[model samples]
Structures are given as structure tokens and as C-alpha cells.
Target: MNKNISAGWRDFHASAKVYYLWLALGWVEIRQRYSRSKIGPFWLTISMGILIAALGVVYGTLFKADLKSYLPLLAVGFVFWAFISTTISEGCNAFIAGSAYIRQMPLSRGIFVFQTIWRNIVILGHNFIIVIAVLAIFKINFLPGLAWFVLGFLLLVVNLFWMSALLAVVCARFRDLPQIITSALQVVFYITPILFKRDMLSKYPLLIDLNPFAHMIEIVRGPLLGEPVPAVSWLACTAMAVVGILICLAFHGRYRSRIPYWV
Candidate 1:
């Protein structure tokens, strides 16, 4: 892990123009995502608004929950779920998607993984507006200490970065991984507390303790709900991130050059 970071640091510093290159690629990603749409980025806003409305009207009633009471939790949970879902799903193709560049250019392989994460963050930015709008309309009294939520978001991004690095290398060589990962993510969606309140786990406290996704989502939403942070879970996830980075770095260092051939 240390070796990979050292190498990455050297590579990053050696190139004076890497920022310009990454910025250009990031901008291109933004354009490519919205190129065919008429209204471009607003499509994200519209899609999320409709989905939330549909679920709020449909599932909220089916679950016998009040729209005003549950909509805020649902919206926030769904938005963060989108972040985790897309980052991993896209990470599986991060290397494959940039095959042309990997083969033809002398760019760092890490850049592609970073680009995937960056693009997902941009998409999250668009979807976040819908969450904020929903929270406002329903008059949900979210936490006033905004800094904690920001801290949680930064950690979430850090976690996604680690996941992307590992998956990008693994799926580069094993291309079918994307489909399998997407399927697993679908199952995770149901088990995650996206459509229900956290208190629903009162009788099933074991479920709360076992769910990694639950902890991940809670780190971000707990602050928003005026709840206290979970220090133990946060530390545990940080350890996982460290171990994940080691594994990913070992794999990436071994196969970084082979990526072009695989792609």
C-alpha cells in the first residue's frame, strides 16, 4: 500500500500537466452524460423528483406511513444509496470504459478510476438538489450543524475512492464483473434502509449491527436527522478502507500495466 502511494505520488508530481488533463477528462465526462438529453442535467432532477414522488405516494401508503413523516428519510437514504450504487457499479467498468485511452495514451491508470468517482460525484450533485427540495417542502427539521454532514460526505467520498481503485483493477481483467456487481447491488438496495426509518430496526437490532450499508448510510444521514455520530462504526469502516486499499494497491501495482492488454 505504501509503495503504491509512493509511486502514485511520484507519478502525480512528475507530470506538471496532470491537473489540466484530469480536468479536461472530467469536463468531457459531464458533457457525455448529458449530450443526448434535451435539457441536459435537469434530467437528473426530474428523474429523482418523479421516483421520490412515486415511492412516496405508492410505498408510503402501502407501508401505512405518512408522506410528511417518512419522505425526508426516504429521499435522503435514496440519494446516498445512489452514490454507493453508482460508484461501485461504475467502478466495475472504470477500466473497460477507458480502454481506448489506456491503450493509446500514456496516462496513469488511476486517473480513469478517479474519473469514474468524480463523474459519479457530479451526478450526485445533481440528485442532491432533489433531496434538498424534498426536505424543504416537507418542512423536515434536519440538523442545524451542517459541518458534521459535510464531514460524513467527505468520508463517503473517501470510501468510494478506495472501492473504485480495487474494482477498477479487478474488473479490468475480469470484464463480466460489472453485471455480477450490479446484481449484488440490487439485493443490497432492498436490505438497505432506504424506504424505512431507522427505528424500524428496534426489534431487529441485530440487523442494524450486521448491515455495513446501514452503517455507511447512517454516517451520512445521522447528522442530517439530528442524531449522534457512531464512532465505533466509523472506526471500523476506516479499518476496512485501509485493508481494502492495501489489497487494491497490491493488485493495482501488479496489474497496472496489464490493464492495456486486458482492455
Candidate 2:
């Protein structure tokens, strides 16, 4: 077991040195996606802007919440969710999708996972414009603890890396897992406090307390909204990150050799 764990760390260390390769590949993938398009990734910003506008009005009226409060929250939530959901869903196929490269090149599987993260992060950058605009419109001043947003976001990325690594291996081995993950995320979206306010769940506050995604969202979104950083959120998210890292390291070490055959 120790040998396997050591081998996995060695593979990851080797892969870390080739950051430029995966970073370039991730950018190239985005460029190729919009190679012939006039607007390029801006199309994502436009569509998301429209979706948030429509949902904000509809749900705002439905729930009788102030647009001033709800729109900004919804906009930020949508952008972060896009980053989180895509990272997880697409991550399941990160290794399998890169089978051609995996089979031909001597690369660490970690590169493919980073590629997936980079691609979504680029898209998230585009959506972030809308978040800033919404905050400005609402007169939400930037707070001193805004630095916590950076901390929370980096922690989230840590969790995402482990998740991508684990899922890439698991889904490569089990063909049906990608489909199951998709369905599970769909369910999670509704349960998460993105579309609704936490106040509504006053009777069952545990719903939000128990949700890792809610904690993840709040830690980032709270600072953006100039709200107090929830101590529980930071604690829960960090604990989850540690657990995810252990799981990913163990799995990668044990199955690193088998990935090529599975893919």
C-alpha cells in the first residue's frame, strides 16, 4: 500500500512539471471550440446573461424576493455552479476522452484532469463579468474580507482536482458512471441553495448545513455579497478537501497502471 501511494505521488510530481503542456492544450481546446465563431466565448456570457435575467424576474416574482438581493445572488450562484458542475461531469470522462493521447504519449493522468479544470475555468472567467455587473447594479460594496473569496475558491479548486482524478479513473473503468453522475448533479442543483434563499429553509436549516455544495457556494458567495464568512462552511469545506485528496491519492496509486487498459 505504501509503495502504491508513493508511486502515485511520483506520477503526480512528474506531471506537475509539464504544466505548460496541459495549460496550452486547455487553451487550444477553447480556441478550437470557437475557431470560426465571431463572438467566441462571449457567446457563453451572452446566453448566461439572458438566462439569469429571465430566471431572476420569474423566480423573483414567484418567491416575492427583491430583485436587488436575488439577482446578484442568482447570477453569482449560476456562474460558480457552472464551474463546479462541468468540472465534475466532464471530469468523469477526462481520461477516457483523452484516450488517443493517453495511449500515444507518456503522460500522467493528472494532466487530463487539469485540462478539464482549465477549460471550465476559462469559461467561468467569461461568466464572471456578469457577476461583477450584477453586484455593481445592486450597490454591493467590496468588503475587506473579500480576500476570503480567493481562499474559498482555491480550496474549491483543491477539492475539484481530487474529484477529477478520482472520477476520471472510476468512470474510465465503469462506463455507466458518467450517466449516473449527470443525474445526481441534476438532483443536487435543486437541493442546493442557489435558486432559493437559506431563510426559506429556517425549519430545516440542516439541509443547507449538511450540503457540501452550499458550504462551497456560501464561502465564495458570502464574501462577494459582503456577508460574514460562515465558520462552519470553511471548516466543512476544508475537511472535505482533505478527505477527497486522500481518496484520490489512494485510487490513483492503486489503479494508475490499469487506466490505459480501461480507457
Candidate 3:
């Protein structure tokens, strides 16, 4: 058991040392995805902008929300949710998608997980343009609490890395897990406070309180909207990251060697 833990830590450390390789690979993926398109990755920005606008109008009316406030909130929530959801969905294929490389070289499996996270982070950057636009148009003064966003985003990424790592190993073996995860995230999307505010569910406070994603989104979104960062959110995300990483490390360590065959 100790040897397995050590091996997992070694694999994680070695992958971190080869940051250049995965970083370049992630960039290459973004480029290839938009290759030959005139606007290139700006297409991501455009699409997200369109989605935010459309959803903002529709849901804003349905909920009788003011466009001014609702649009900005929706924009921020959607952008971050995109990063979280896509990273998790892609994580399911972190090892399976890189089967060729895994088979051809004795590379650390964690490298592929890093690549998956980095790629989505790049996409997140592209989508964040819409968030910036929303903030500017609404004149939401975010500078005062920008520091909290930095901390929150870091915690969000750390939690995502562990999620991706754990899913990568498990999905490589199950193959069916990716579809299941996708379906589950669809349900979670509705439950999460993306399109609406938590106060809307005043009677069902537990819904938001129990949701880790709600806390994850709140930590970042709250600051950008100039709302005070919730102490509970910070505590939840911090505890989740620490506990999730430990659990992921143990699971990945036990199953690391089996990934090659599974893929």
C-alpha cells in the first residue's frame, strides 16, 4: 500500500516536472480544434456570448428577472460551469483518448489528465471574454473583491484536477462511465445556481447548501459580482479539494498500472 502511494506521488511529481510537454500539447489541441477557421478560437467566445444572450432573454422573462443583473449573473455562472462540466466530461477520456501515446511510451498517466485540464482551461479563457463584456456593460465594480476570485479560481482548478484524475482512471476501465457522467451533469446543471439565484429557492435552502458545485460557483461568482465571499463556500471548497485529492491519489495509485491495459 505504501509503495503504491509512493508510486502515485512519483507519477504526479514527474508529470508536474514535464509541464512544458503537456502545456504545448494543450495549446496544440486548441489550435487544431479551430484550425482553418478564420475567427479561430474566437468562435468559442462568440458562441458563449450568443448562448448567454439567448438564455438571458428567455430565462430572464420566465423568471421575471431584470436583464441588467440577471444577464451578468448568467454569464459568469455559464462560463465557469462550462469549464467545470467540460473538464469532467473530457477527463473521462484522458487516458482512453491518449491510448496511442500510452501504448507507445511509458509516460505518466497523470500527464494526460493535466493535458485535459489545461485544454479546458484554455477554453475557459476564451469563454471568459463574455464574462468580461457582461461585467463592463453592467458596470459591475469587481476590482474590490478580485483577490477572492483569484483564490477561488485556484481552489476550483485544484478540485478539478483531482476530479479529472480520478475520472480518467475509472473511465478508462469502465468505458460506459463517460455517458453516465454526462447524463448526471445535465441533472446537476439544473440543480446548480447557474440560470438563477439561490435565494429563489428560499424554502429549499438545503439544495444549494449541500451542493459542492454551488459553493464552487459561488466562490468565484460572488466576488466578481461584488458580493461578500461566503465563509461556508471557502470552507467547503477547501475541504473538498483536500479530501478529494487524497481519495483520488489512493484510487489512482491502486489502478495506475492497469490503465494501459484498460485503454
Candidate 4:
């Protein structure tokens, strides 16, 4: 019998606990999200729908773009932005929020970091339905090819996990790190093709070349655009994942013990 599990080279049953923990964390996030809203999770769907309508009108007309084209981009970009921006901001307090658990339990620090990202993914999953609805409302043809889109999504999650681990450790150690991340993300939004197009990049080629968020957005958005991403981009992200994972591992090894204390 094969007993080696793939991810950590451990037993399958042992790693199964992590998946269950993800489920539990996701459940908690869902509950907390709706605790204040009367409509609960439906608030996400309704709010997004309204924003899409308003922004689609204003930005589309401002840019002289058609609704069919602009709305789809807006939907996908916002959905992806929710994941990225949420990961960055939430990661700053990931350990701090769970100070009691970190101090009390001999738990896998990696799992809690992963939990922060996974919980957001679950929320984003709920929000993707809104994207689909926006597509239908705007009459944009969305590709239903599960394999390609799912692969892109999985890669995005992988990147998030690595990022969350690294950011959580940093923020736990440096309280001001969260504010710096917020500032960086604000600068990134203006440059990203969110309310604009790749034309913005063409206008300033140097900006696009230097903007990591552009590459990050394309890694997921390219597939949704029916353009399977170029191998160069894919390879670059893979290399990034490797480097990020290594950094997180080093952080985990060195400071996982100190996280609760720092928090």
C-alpha cells in the first residue's frame, strides 16, 4: 500500500485534517460575514450587482467602451481584486486575530495562514456567482470550460496560500506592515487594468513591465478572456511560487514559535 501523501510527504489521513480545518474556517467566515446584514450573504451579491451597474455605466461611458465588453471585464476584475486585496489586508491581522489559538495550541502555524487565505477563497467563491449573474445581465458570453478556468483558479489559490503565510508572519512581527501593504495596493489599483484596459499599459510600457499586479491579474484573467496565458507568464508565476514558498517556509521555521507572543 502507498502511504506517502503528495503535499508534505506524509500519510493521507494525517493531511486530511487540514482539509477539514479549511472547511471549518470557511464556515466560520461565512457566519461572521452575515452576522450583521439582514440579507446575509445575499448582501454580497446585491451590492456587487448594484456596483457593477453603476460603475459599468460611469466607467464604460467615460472610456467610450461598450457595456458588453466593459461589464465582463469589471466583473472579473472585481472578483479577482476581492481575492487579492482581501488577502493582503486580512493577512496583516491573521495571526493577531487568532492569538488565543496560537498561544494555546501546538497547531500547525502554516494551517492558520492557509486558513486565512482559504476562508477568503470561500467568500470569493460565493462572489463568483455574482460575476456570472453580471455576465448574463450584460449579455456577455462567458466560457463554461471548467478545466481551464479551474486550473487558473487553483493556481491563484496556490499563490494566495504562499502569500498569506509570508504576509502573516511579517505583519505579526511588524505592526505598521499592514498600513504599508494598504498603501501599496492603492497605488497598484490605479495602474492595474481594473477600471481601464491594457491600453493603459500600452500608454506606459514601463509601468506594465514593472507592475507585478499586472502579471498577477493576467495569470487569472487571461484564461477568462479565452486566451490561455503565454507559457512565459505561467513559468514566471511558477518560479514566483517556488520563491514565495521558500520564504514562507523559512519564516515558518524561524518564527512560527514566536507568532503568538508577537501577536
lDDT (Cα atoms) of all candidates against the true structure:
0.78, 0.89, 0.92, 0.72
Which residue pairs in model 1 clash with each other? Answer: none
lDDT of 4 by residue, 170-194 (tens): 8899999999998989888888878
User: Which residue runs of candidate 4 sit more than 4 Å off their true CA positions?
Assistant: 1-16, 36-38, 138-141, 228-230
Residue 166's lDDT in candidate 2: 90
TM-score of each: 0.89, 0.97, 0.97, 0.87
Which runs of model 3 end up more than 4 angstroms from their true locations? none
The window of 10 residues in a row where model 1 has the poorest summed lDDT is 8-17
**Model 4 clashing-pair count:** 0
lDDT (Cα, tens digit) per residue for candidate 1, span 1-263? 67766665444344334666656687798898789878887787788889988988888989899888678778888889988998999888888988888889888877777777777888888888987787779766666847878877877877787788778878877877888989999997887788877677688876766777787898888777666767866875677667766666666766676888888
Question: For residues 40-89, what per-residue lDDT tens digits would candidate 2 score against the true structure?
Answer: 99998999999999999999999999999999889888889988999999
Ranking of candidates on lDDT, top first: 3, 2, 1, 4
Q: Candidate 4: global Cα-lDDT?
A: 0.72
- Candidates by TM-score, descending order: 3, 2, 1, 4
**For candidate 2, what is the lDDT?**
0.89
Q: On a 0 to 100 scale, what is the lDDT of residue 184 in model 3?
A: 97
Question: Could you tell me the lDDT of residue 242 within candidate 3?
Answer: 93
Screening candidate 4 with a backbone cut-off below 3 angstroms (N, C-alpha, C), the clashing residue pairs are none
Q: Is candidate 2 or candidate 4 better by lDDT?
A: 2
Count of backbone clashes, every candidate in sequence: 0, 0, 0, 0
